[model samples]
Target: LGDLAARRFAGGDRAGALAAVEEGLRYGGQAAGHAPEYARWYARGLINQGVWLAWPLSDEVRLPRYPLGPRAGSGPSAMERAAGERALDLTRAAVEVWAALDQRDPVNRRGLAQAKVFLGDRLAELGSAEEAVAWAVDAEGGFRHLLRAAPGAEEAQEAEEALDHIGRQLELRLRFLSFDSLVSLRARGLLPEPLLPQAVVAARIQGVAEPEIAGGLRLDAEQVRTMLEVTPWLAVWRFEVRGPDGLWNVQGHPSHGATEVRNRTAEDIGNELIRGFTASADCPGEGAPWRLLLWWHEEGDPAGARFRAAGGPDTAPEGTADTPS
Candidate 1:
């Protein structure tokens, strides 16, 4: 159903696109109990339905049409807001599914990391930065473990770059209070928007009812906890929207799928994420509004050009360390 809708959307069938997602949102939920595959259908269906293709593959998906809520400078349309809200709900479900899986399984560890990372990015994009940051940090840790198993592989390098970005973001939050010292901010990512506003941080991180950037650093709940634990001074802001090669963009796509994000734990985390989104059709969740966001985080690594030849958007080389030893 979603594939048909995506085909229709790709063919410029707006009505078909809408109808497909509509049915997908519904039936996909219903399938959770009786059919697990429907959950996968929901993820792909969304990409196809929401993704408005341009002439080139690079610009295939239309960013503006996405369901993300309104920004300060912009107000979302009724439908876009609704869709964004729905996407947010479903994406959260997806997170639940993956979270229930075991992470220590040697053979499936890689997939677990990948799923967490993918879900984190989608959550943040869908309007949950705090949640995304938390999960992404964990994903970074998971990916680091995988990289250790095969330090020479291209996938390991890719994971390293991604971990670096996530780490940077984590550090940025850790150093939110120090964002104004000029030199302090410079020490982190490209001097944060000098005037990015403390309000943004206050409003973003959770449990930080009131946020203040003392010495250009946020003394938020999480940071405070870290501070109490003896880990003080924080630095870095790692979020990439650019690329380095055919694989230049430093963001990943949802289609990269379970193994890459799951860190080889696809069967477990993938199944869980599927269940999370699927459950929305009933009880604690209602919308079953399944949603996902996929992108590669290249972190501006110069070696990306060569990596592109072998790992471009259309190509994901099978990792040599994938034998599941």
Candidate 2:
């Protein structure tokens, strides 16, 4: 059943893979109820299910490698948050089962150690940094003990590689604070808004130049420099979301939700924006074009008038001075 699940996952049928593991776990539990030896199968099934739920939240899955901050637009979706919590719970259960099995028979020690490593990674994702490091250290110690007991074994080499991987993950965790931690600090008023501290750390992690950071964020170069220098010294213990505002609410933004727009002509897009404002009674429909034109100028996009008037035969307008008057 586990093999079937793996094949389904590799074939890109994620929903099918998840369903297979869930069914496999149910069957494993039924078998374990009838026989003590089948408990190992149930435990293994738990680990597999937990991994599938957690995989999308892992560093291996996310792009651009910005663990310290939410991306430019939205933070993790609600589904991602739910999956991370479920993964942590399932992995913790698996660790308990593996520990009991190892106590009964030392041959199960390898499984116990590996599960610990996985649990540590989940903890790290959910913003339990210290606990995550502690679990990794404990797993490393277990692997080292196994290597000492079975010198020159194939599993010994695998344990060494696991140790190296754990070390690298720990180093990364130490060097950069997690996204959850930064959000928590902002909630407590320790960090101010409009200049997201997480963005500063992310820029540093990606080796972005200070001047570039300032330009992108529209901040003074010295402010960017100070944030880059001061952020690393702050300590973080846990990840907490205090309110809806803490999450990236991209609901009414142009990029997400029911009213999202894409692949439309500039005139159509501008009309949509004007309709939205007029519907809210913020501006009269007749005055929308000139008001939008003024806003674009204020935002330093003088050529935005082209976007506002771009439905005619020649869609492209000549210069920044071109307005809808």
- Give per-residue CA lDDT, model 1, range 1-325, as digits (tens): 6667668867978676678677776776576445334544444444333332211111134222221222212344556555555554554565454444454553346555655665554544443444445566677777778777765567777777877767655543322121233224333433333223322332222112223433334435555333333321111112122233422232233322322221111122333433443343221122112222211221222211101112213333221100000
Q: In model 2, which regions exceed 4 Å deviation? A: 33-37, 59-74, 177-325
TM-score of each: 0.39, 0.52
lDDT of 1 at 112: 54
Top lDDT prediction, candidate number: 2
Tell me the tens digit of each residue's lDDT in model 2 across 1-325: 7899999999988788899999988888788656546877888888888878877766554321223222212334679868878988989988887787635354578788888988878877765654665677678778878887865667877889998887766555443333343333334443334335445554443335567656655568887777766654221111111233444211223221122222222344445554554454333233212233211111222322233221112233211222111
Query: Each prediction's Cα RMSD?
Result: 22.5, 15.6
Clash counts for the predictions, in order: 46, 0
Q: How accurate is candidate 2 locally (lDDT)?
A: 0.56
lDDT of 1 at 28: 65
Residue 144 displacement (Å), model 1: 2.5
